[model samples]
Target chain A: MVDPEIRVVTIDDLGILRSVQEDPATGRVVVTITPTYTGCPAMDVIRADIRRALVATGHPDAEVRTVHKPAWSTDWISDAGRAKLAAAGIAPPAPARRDGVVPLTLAVRCPRCGSPETEQISRFGSTACKALWRCRSCAEPFDHVKAL
Target chain B: MNGPFTFALALGDDSLIAAQRLAEWTTRAPEMEEDVALANIALDQLGAARLLLTYAGELEGAGRDEDALAYLRDDREFRNCLLVELPNGDFAVTMAKLLVLAAYQVPLYTALAVCPDERLAAIGAKARKESAYHLDHAMLWVKRLGDGTEESHRRMQAGVDQIWPYVDELFTTWPDAPVDPAVLRPGFDDTVTEVLTTATLTVPQVSWTPAGGRDGVHTEHLSYLLAEMQVLHRAHPGARW
Candidate 1:
């Protein structure tokens, strides 16, 4: 199912959907997901959507387990998902910064004009998953999926 | 006090209270983006609180769940440090509080990430990443406001001084904790000092070491905060959205 927020990216494409184990014999299914953020409000909706999808596929007994051992990272977003996000006017995240270094962002190319002349408007946006940015080239405001 | 249950409860209470305090900034922050930022940080704290409280309840082996532990408890039952329970004084004060809270949490969670407790470790492994972000955000604001202008610098310093006395309570010894609170002090000091120095703010020097939140002795502010927070649940028990 597509992400309830972004709408253009599927759960698989976003990689929050960790694994799905299904038993054809008993029609039993177990799905595991790691939340993009520990406080992500989307998890409940995503779980419900997964259950609905499973029921539609004839897997009536399904277990959706949430795990946190291996934390979620923006790097998990697939390349195709990035493409879909850019196509939808939302800038995909930059490479996940490592070693806890405060990333010095040199540039964020405007999704609309592909020019590196974009400025961050705020460190936060409409949702926890993205930041607000303004494109200098196109003079358009956009959301950038923040790198965590 | 030695039980892991109380240890987890204390940690949970810290996050829960912090979340509630941050959430108070919703619709009231100085700017629209700040409103969203505080709300999101509040959500993160709430998220971590839920996991810790759930684990604490399980460890207690009592009938209490996260909601029961959270909603049914009164101020005296809460284990959050006074720093979190204090009223949001001003924008600078709020940022100062966030700076210290996130500074402490990052090291605490990072230490928890490698601790022997599997569940806490999992929670920590996930939470440390988020705490790092929170810490970064707070540092940015602290430095900006601390060094910005004459009035801004004065207010930021005052904010740090106002919140400083309560800071010592967070690092008191907890022998049964996954990572003893004392052990986390050095890291916390390092992080806070650097940010404060860069921000042109002093790390307030205070002789008063008021403590005892672990044993559920909180300040008067907690009672009022809990009255507002737990009122809905107490009025309509077990109500859900």
Candidate 2:
């Protein structure tokens, strides 16, 4: 299913869908999902969507579990998903260094014009997962999925 | 007091109270971007607080949930450090507070990530990633405002001085806590000093450090914050949207 917030990508594409398994004890379909951010309001909606999908697929006895062990990261977003995000006018993130250093500001290219000249308008955007940026070449504003 | 219970409770309270304070800037931040940034950080704090408080309640085994522990308790019952409970006196003050708070949390949560406690480790590992972002954001602002204009520099220095005394309370040693606060002090000092130095702000050398927030003795400001935060929850008791 597409993310309830960003409809350009599916849950699998976004990497929030962690696993689908069958419980040994209860013999029920168990689906596990991870959240990109702890306070993401989309989680409840995603859970409800997963449940609805299961009901439609004849697995009314499904169990959806939320896990937080390894934490979610922007690195998990698939390449195809990144393309989709760009096509939708949202710039995808570069690989985030795991050492927690904030990268330099001048790297993000404009999604619309593919120009390397872009300035960050805000570190935060319309959604928690993205940042606001404006292209110098095309002069169009866009969103960039933040590299966590 | 149960050491683990108190430890978890204190950390959780820190996050909860800090989140509330940051969220107060939702529409009132000087700019729209800042409004979103502070709210985003606030959301991260709230998320960590939920995981922490839920675990704390389980450790206590007293039937209290995150909501009950967060909403039902009076200010006197809170175990948060005084730093978080203080008012957002100025924009610079808010940045100063965030810089200090995130500095402490990055090390604290990083240490906790590898600690022996399973649930705490998991939560720590997850939340630390977000804390790193908060630290970066705070550092950016602290430097920008602290080194900007003469007036901006003056206010930023004042903000740091106002908040510095509260900093000592956060690093009080709790050897029994999941990750002892003493161990995290060095990292905090390093981060804060580097930022303040680059920003051309003097690190305050205050002799009189007022504390006692961990034991629930907070400034009167906490009561007003709590009154607003808990009002809706207390009014409806089990309210849900």
Candidate 3:
């Protein structure tokens, strides 16, 4: 059987898995996911998607659980996911700052023109996970995945 | 009611009502970007409400789920602060109210993050991060509008003054609560003062303070808000989109 982690990653493409393991005798895959944020709406969708992916992979019964131990950080997003975001015209989040001091403005490089001269138009964007930014070089508006 | 159950429900009601008010700004905000931002913020609050309400149901050992608790409850049964139930009068009012609530939530959730209850603590940890963003958003707008044109400054200060009476209730506390509301006062005061200072706005000095939402007493606005919010759910019970 394929690893459940791979299935979860394939389904969500957010690289949110903390761990996944299958019981050898019971064939029940137990998947653990770390939520992007406490109030993130994606967690529910991700849980259902993980279950569906496992079922499609011949594991009919699987348990999807959430863990909040180390908490989720933007650093958990994989390289492939970051690339996907960039390709989709969404600037990927910068590495999270540990000091809890939020900068008044973030220097988000535009995904379209790769310009560093992007200004935040809004603190929030199309979704809670992103911020709206306008690129000076391209003069195009894009979403920047927020660092959290 | 059990301590955790009541506590969770209070927090849940606060988020749910705040979400409803925020959602109303979707098409009415001054700008398209503001509309999108308000909706995002509303969705975040809604998500938090769902988690807390679901946990509350579990703690109560009641058969009610998140939907039941959210849609089926009467206004008098809700435990949200009166500040959240007030109508979203204008963009300035919305921002001012959000600033106060978000500032309060930052410290409330931060303290709750260390509660003995593991699930509540986990929720608190996650919520604290979201509240920080909410506070930041409110702060920026409050500053911009308060320090902007004369008209903008007038509206912003009016919004602050209007909401000030409802502020005192947010610091009320009960025994066995996840975090004492009084304990959050210092942090709340500092945060609000910092933003108001930058905005060049003075805090309102109101002699009369409004209270009683925690004990299920709410302003008349709550009924209308609940009617609108609960309509579709009431129309089609058990319906899912």
Stretches of candidate 2 above 4 Å error? Answer: none
In model 1, what is the error at residue B218, expressed in angstroms? Answer: 0.4
Model 2 TM-score (B-chain only) = 0.98
User: Per-residue lDDT tens digits of candidate 2, residues A28-135?
Assistant: 899999999887879999999999999999899999999887878889999999999999999999887776555656499899999999999998888778889999
- Candidate 2 global Cα RMSD: 1.3
| By TM-score: ranked, best first | 2, 1, 3
How many Å off is the CA of B81 in candidate 1?
A: 1.2
Of 2 and 3, which scores higher on DockQ?
2
Tell me the spans in candidate 1 whose CA falls farther than 4 Å from its real position.
A23-27
Docking model 1 quality class: medium
- How does residue B213 of candidate 1 score in lDDT? 87
User: Per lDDT, what order, best first?
Assistant: 2, 1, 3
Model 2 Cα lDDT, one tens digit per residue, B55-165: 999999999999999999998899999999899988999999999999999988888888999889988888888898899899999999889999999999999999998
Per-model DockQ against the true two-chain complex: 0.71, 0.71, 0.54
* Native contacts recovered, each model: 0.73, 0.64, 0.51
Q: How many backbone clashes does candidate 1 have?
A: 0
Model 1: colliding residue pairs: none
Q: In angstroms, how far off is B67's CA in candidate 3?
A: 1.1
Interface RMSD, every prediction, one decimal place: 1.5, 1.3, 1.9
Q: Where does the lowest 10-residue lDDT sum fall in candidate 1 chain A?
A: A97-106
Q: How far is B183's C-alpha from truth in model 3 (Å)?
A: 0.6
lDDT of 1 by residue, B1-241 (tens): 3478888998899999999999999999999989999999999899999999999999988778999999999888888888999999999999999999999988888889889999999888778777887888899999999999999999999999988998889999878677998988888898899999998888888998788887888889999888899899999987899
